[model samples]
Target chain A: MIKVNQLKKSFNDLEVLKDINFEVKRGEVLSIIGPSGSGKSTLLRCLNFLETPNAGTITIDGLTVDVENVKKQDIQQLRKKSAMVFQNYNLFKNKTALQNVTELLIVTKKMPKAEAEKIGMEYLAQVGLADKANKYPVTLSGGQQQRVSIARALALNPSVILFDEPTSSLDPELVSEVLQVIKQISTKDTTMIIVTHEMDFAREVSDNVIFMADGYIVEEGHPSQLFGNPQQARTKSFIQQLNEKH
Target chain B: MNFDIGYMFSLIPEIMEYIPITLFMAILAMILTIIIGLLLTFMRSSKLKVLNYIATVYISFFRAIPMLVQLFLIYYGLPQLFPVFTKMDAVTAAVIGFGFKQAAFASEIFRAAFLSVDKGQMEACLAGGMTKVQAYQRVIIPQAFRNALPATGNTFISLIKETSLAFTLGVVELFAEAKMQASNTLRFFEAYLAVALVYWAIVVIYSFLQSKLERLLEKPYRT
Candidate 1:
């Protein structure tokens, strides 16, 4: 389980995440949908200490981090519990696909090379890219690269996976393939917090959804309750706007 | 006033004898420069204000002064301040001098290369449970090396040519040998021309090898 209490973050004088509060049960998929500048990405980053929170506490599984005074060990512990999939598919450009998946396993986890390769190959096959294991990221398409990144994240088997708009950077035609992979993983008991603009995908896969605006969680509930009948005026209008666009 | 093409051609083999010395100085100096340059890059990136300040001043001081002046200070003047420097050989003095001066330029090349790597790469490493130091070792430095290759090649080629300056310090390198031959035969034109051709040939060969290396390293990133 993950719980956040009164989390706040700011860049210089501008507040990006203000008094945010939420929680996710183990094995639940929660999707955060918001407009640009709504701090959805910043909120996700703060969970991993990529962007340190100004105040509040983040409790992941049994470890609770006081964001105001986190130590090096706390940040490392927080990262160990979660893996992030970036929108741009940030694979190590110097390594082949299989090496990208196995790098952390070998370097940080101290797993033997042969064991790491075996696990990496299994995850690569899971993402349907086993044949492309020896290929570098540049040699693959954006969709294929994103799949490799997904495989890399899955190999870690973190308590939770954070997707920061994983399909935002891909082409329109390529977006569906990546989404299909995510949907496939959603069927498993993996806990995932996805911050995305793909409203349809979020509605389909998320167990719970949070609608945020201007650095605040405007509303939250089950996907049907939140999407079908948003209680807050802001949530209603945000959903309306997205509905019109698609 | 007469130019003898055959004599200039014949001077090549004799002048070639000193090629090893010139190469030795250049190769050693380049190694030192890269080491010092990497250290400076780390210092500049370090959070301590004092380290950053020292790195800035060091880079500025080396870059602002002429290499010839720096060479003379190391060869002639350093022994006055530290008696141990008196034991340093002419080749050692020349290599150390060149290394310090060229590192200022090489550090900038390394800095630019590190910056060229996408910010996402580091974040990915961190998010994957690697520490900052491990991130640099496994991902950041390797990519930065590829980016630094072409510029480093240029620095090395220039370093080879700059080894000619070591002649002033009584180091009998290729250019110094040519100078001796010129003074002996009183045929300054042929002797100097022979050395110049040799230098040009070395640069051409190194440039070819550099391009080949660039292509080989670029394989992973090739689209």
Candidate 2:
């Protein structure tokens, strides 16, 4: 469903993603665990063209996006196919939760207002915030706001959903509500590429886990294999460090 | 002639006549300033280099020139250059001069408001699948207007006081009317005192409106 080869990116002289190659099958969950500033978030952003890659090609369903040639219609279609949930939530503070979801559907997709609102309410209910649909983002807890953000992405029916440290901003108590939502979402056929620090959640949920450091994917295999008995000294060292962390 | 308190108070009918004309100029100049000021703001923020440069130069030139000089330029300079403008009166010239002059200042207020808007709001709007125009209208511009409302109200209070300068151009507004009354009746002190009272009353009312507007616009964002 997704493919990348020699995917290189850099900010000026500082390379962020160096010679990364990876692929994921349809309906698979791929978790990218990495150190701070390892370009995991940048890779997620590149998938949707929010931040254009500095080099290399990303192909999804035969649509190629890269530095040389990216078609206009393909980018728009790719954006629809890939939805992103940010750490900050990025909800429009001026809009209610209902307005947030229905906004793009009505404005960009040209869905009828009434139809969009109905579907929006359904999604809000799915995320367990049906009563809070009319409330502004300011009125919501960090966890509730993150759920609203998930509903917003779900309403679009994207093929691939990207999560960038989704629960990083929430309280420890609130993180479960958001993680539960993601766990429930995983039961479906939707593909997911999650970048997160929640090790237990990552180990329990991800079908494949890739450990990254210094802009390179140092290890990639089934999570059970990588988490159980790893081969590399660097991978075992980072996992040992992470065991002491939690 | 010991301050003739009773007689000075009796000039009510005379001062009332000038109030409407004064308000008319303030309202007209305010309307003109906001419309053209918004245009200048768009030019200043736009990508076109020449247009942005022109907007910058226009703002600097008007802001640098004194209002009195701007009034004189419109009243005296325009008549000499265009014979067709000879029929235009002092009131028209005052509106033209003050309106353009205030626009330079108002554009800065708008620019600041536009800048304070969160960059993420636009990106999120686009990610939700909104087109560029839809994102700007739905997500960016409304929030910018809310941010701009309080600062723009301050400009309105200053504009009302600036109307006093219109009298210098011989527009016969409140200040000019008071001056004419003082000179004719030899009640210079009483006449100027009435003018002061009138200006104070207008400002007090406008200040109340400014606070009311700020409160109403801020209701949604106040949390």
Candidate 3:
């Protein structure tokens, strides 16, 4: 389980996340949807300590960290509990796909090379890229690179996976391939927090959905309830704007 | 005096005897430059203000002054500043001068290379449960080096040419040998031309090796 309370963040004088709060039960998929500059991505990054919040407590699987006074060990432990999939598919450019997946296991987990390779290849197979293991990321398409990143994240077996707009950077024709991979992962008992703009995918796969606007959670409930019948005026107009654009 | 092609050819083999000295100085200086440059990079990148300031001043001073001036200072000026330096030989001073200048340039190259790597790579490594140090060792530095190869190749080629200055300190390198041969034979034109050819040939060969190294480094990055 993951829980965040009174999370507040600001850049110098401008507040980005204002007293935001949310929680996700184990094995649940929670999707955070909002317009641009609504602090959705910042919230996802804060959970992983990529952007430290000015105030809050993040608890994951019984380990908690106060945002203001975090220690090195706490950060490492918190990071070990979660893995992130970035929008740009930040694979190690110098490494082949197989090596990218195997590096963390060998470096962080201290697993034997043969064992790590086996698991890495298995995850590559799972992502339908087993044949491309020898290829470097520069040679792969955006969709394929994102899949490799996903495989890399999956191989670590973290308690939760935080995806910050994983498809936001892909070309239109390539979006489905990556979304399909995430959809497959959502079927398993993996806990996930996805901040994305893909409303249909979110409505289809998410167990709970939160609508954020200007750093505040305007509405929260089951995906169908929130997407089908948004209660607040802000949530209604936001969903309306998205539907109009579609 | 007319240029004598045949005499210059004859002088090639004799002058070539000192090729080892030039190469030895260049190789030693190259090694020292790499070590000092990396250390400077670390100091510049460190959070300590004092270390960063010192590294900055060091890079600036070495880069600002001419290589010849630096060589003279190390060989002639050093003994004046510190009496112990009176015992230091010209060859040692030449190595120190060339190596120090190369390090300044190399530090900038490496620092720029490290900056060229996307910031996302570091975040991705951290998210994978790797420490900051491990991320740098395993991911960031490797990619940064890839970005730095072409510039580093240029630096290395320049270093090879710059070693010619050592002859001014009376180290008897390729140029020094040619100078001596010309003084004896009074064939200044032939001797200087032969020395120039040797240096040109060495640069060409080293450039070829550099391209091959670059190709190997770029293999993984090729689309």
Candidate 4:
């Protein structure tokens, strides 16, 4: 389970996440949807300590971190509990796809090379890229790279996986291939928090959906409730704008 | 003023004898410059006020002064303050001078190379559960080194040529050997031209190796 209370973050003088609060039970998929620059990504990043929050406590699978005085060990433990998939893929440009997946295993976990390679190959096969294991990231398509990234995150076996606009940087035709890989894993036991702009995918895969606007959570409920009947004016207008575009 | 082709050819064998001295000093200086350059880069990026200030001032000071002046200070001036420096050989003094001066330039190249790598690469490593130090060691440094190769090669080539100034401190290197041979026989043009050919050959060989290494490192990034 993951819980955040009164989370606050600021860049210089400008506040980006303001008194945010939420919870996700184990094995639940929560999707956060909002217009651009609404702090959705920042909120997700704060959970992983990527952007250190100014105040609040975050509990991931029973390890609570108080942001005000978090230690380096606490941050490392937090990262160990969760892995993030970035929009740009960000695979180690120097490593082949299999090496990218196995790097942390061998370096941080001290697993033997053969054991790590076995697990890496399994994850690569899971993402349907087993044949591309030895290929460097530069040789793969953007979609393939993102799939390898997803495979890398899956291999960590973290308590929660954070997807920050994973498809935001892919070509239109390649989006489905990457999304299919995410959907394949969403059915498993791992908890997930996804901040994305793909409304249809969110509505389909998420158990709970959150609508954020200007750094505030305007509404939260089951996807049916949030999408079918938004209560806040900001959420309603934002949904209406998205609908108009479609 | 006659160009003696035979004398120039004959001078090659004698001048080549000092090639090892030239190469030893330049190679030693290059290694020192890399070590100091990397230290300066880390200090500047350390985010501590005192470290950053020291690194900034050090880089600026070393870059502003000429290599010849710096060599004189180390070889001639240092002995005045510390008697121990009087025992130091001219080769050691020359390497120290060249190392300190060239590091300033090499640090900037390293800085730019580190910056050229994507910010997301470090974040990905961290998210994957590696420590900041591990991230830099395993991912960031390898890519940065590759990016730094071309510029670093240029610095090393220039350093080789700059070792000729060590003759001012009385080290018998390639250029120094050439000067002695020219003075003994009064064949200044032939002897100097022969030495220049040797320097040109060394630069060409190093440049070739550098490009080959660059291509090898580029394998992972090629589409």
Instruction: Return the top candidate by TM-score.
Output: 4
* Index of the highest-DockQ prediction: 4
Model 3 bad stretches (over 4 Å): B1-6, B42-52
DockQ of candidate 2 is 0.53
Better of 2 and 4 by lDDT: 4
lDDT of 4 by residue, B54-86 (tens): 999999999999899999999999999999999
Candidate 2: tens digits of C-alpha lDDT, residues A88-197: 89888888999988887887778999999999999999999999999999889999999999998888887788898999999999999999999888878878999999
Q: What ranking emerges by TM-score with the best candidate at the front?
A: 4, 1, 3, 2
Per residue, candidate 3 scores C-alpha lDDT tens digits across A101-121 of 999999999999999999999
Q: What are the chain B TM-scores of all models? A: 0.97, 0.89, 0.93, 0.98
Pairs that collide in candidate 2 are: none
Residue pair clashes in candidate 1: none
lDDT of 4 by residue, A1-246 (tens): 999999999999998888899999999999999999999999999998888899999999999999998999999989999999999999999999999999999987899999999999999999999999999999999999999999999999999999999999999999999999889899998799999999999999998999998888989999999999999999999999999999
Encode model 2's per-residue lDDT on B1-223: one tens digit a residue: 5586665666645776888888898888888888888889999989999999999999999999999999999898888999888888998889888789989998998888878877777777766556677777888888888887777777776677787888887778778878888888898888888878877888888888877877876765666
Which residue runs of candidate 4 sit more than 4 Å off their true CA positions? none
Candidate 3 achieves a global lDDT of 0.92
Chain A TM-score compared with the true chain A, each model in order: 0.99, 0.96, 0.99, 0.99
**In candidate 1, what are the lDDT values of residues B133-181, reduced to their tens digit?**
9999999998899899989998999899999999999999999999999
Better of 2 and 4 by DockQ: 4
Candidate 1 residue lDDT tens string, A106-184: 9878999999999999999999999999999999999999999999999999999999999999999999999999999
**Poorest lDDT segment (10 consecutive residues) of candidate 2 chain A:** A61-70
